[model samples]
Target: MNELTPDVFDALIGQDFVVTNDDGAKITMSLTAVSRFETGAPATDIDGNPLRAVGFQLTLRGPAQPLLATQAYPVDIPGIGVHHLLMSAFEAGRTAVNYDIVFA
Candidate 1:
């Protein structure tokens, strides 16, 4: 569960996602979040078929609450500047789960 660098996440950035800075405030990406993104296609087994990897799409949801809530919201963090942004496959609900995003 290692933290990914901006370069790594930048590779995944495209036209499907957005990232904003907390007003240029420093922040760290949660390990759990990173882990989810790092999972990718598995190696080929003896069966001769490549293992299927978990697929996922990442959407930047913001206006984060002071505490965790059970519902989901689409908002931006007020006063935050542009830190980093990313978007995966826009074709339907497909996104690469093999990349992690790291922000500062």
Candidate 2:
């Protein structure tokens, strides 16, 4: 199981307000604006250099979509929690990009 420690969990929550569904699906509510502080350094290309433009993506394991805001999961899975999301960062006048997986 990919378990996230408290520190790691805190990092994502600090980045944005996350809304998740019972089926293990989640989305970053503040997607319109990236967090200047929580988001890490700029991303780099394959050559290991910095690049321009920065953003992140939220991912799910299954085909099932997330529940509506009004809906709720019937039960919470013990032990296994926190879904994975792709986080990307970049800067201008560069060719490198950085990416990471955040949990919610």
Candidate 3:
């Protein structure tokens, strides 16, 4: 299993990741974003509960269809646990659309 460790995150760069939406729709995209902060950093959630936050970006490559931010995407990553990504930002390249995602 490809565990969702920091090492795995490094290996995931430029690799394909399967993201499933609420309606169970799945799409394959490249993991193009680097983790901005180190893993296991202390943080607070909306409920003021303590937790760790991790960030990553997904790049929908060449001629890929646009994904609307109408809902959050539950990305399937081993050991990552229920990753729901909100479309944080939109970045358009010459051939790809990068979506900024923040998950805890």
Candidate 4:
């Protein structure tokens, strides 16, 4: 798999991604937005070298029920392959739930 960068997902907005739950159920989520921002302080790599100061957040919309706990989930992105991503439920309404995947 390639790096999970904003560029990798920029073209994916409005597309659908399938997230596999812990119970092995597949939840369909739409890629709603890809928000980018400055990290303020420079981030470091494992070797302690300075990395990019920019970061991004992925917003997805899915069903409201079966509220998913904040954790890593296997998500299948069209043409990007499956990847394990940490996601948290950001909001929930009567019919939909929003999840966020932050890369910082």
Clashing pairs in 4: none
Worst 10 residues of 4 by lDDT: 1-10
Order of all candidates by TM-score, from best down to worst? 4, 3, 2, 1
TM-score of 3: 0.55
User: Among all windows of ten consecutive residues in candidate 3, which has the lowest summed lDDT?
Assistant: 55-64
Name the candidate, 2 or 3, with the larger TM-score value: 3
Q: Give the TM-scores of the predictions, in the order they appear.
A: 0.20, 0.20, 0.55, 0.88
lDDT on C-alpha atoms for all candidate structures? 0.32, 0.34, 0.57, 0.90
Count: clashes, candidate 4: 0
List where candidate 4 sits over 4 angstroms from the true fold.
41-50
RMSD of each: 13.8, 15.6, 5.1, 1.9
Angstrom error of the Cα, residue 6, model 3: value is 4.0
Best by lDDT: 4
Q: lDDT tens digits, residues 14-83, model 3?
A: 7666777556777667777555554575687678876656544334332235454546667665446556
* lDDT value, residue 15 of candidate 3: 69
Let me know the TM-score candidate 2 reaches against the reference structure. Answer: 0.20
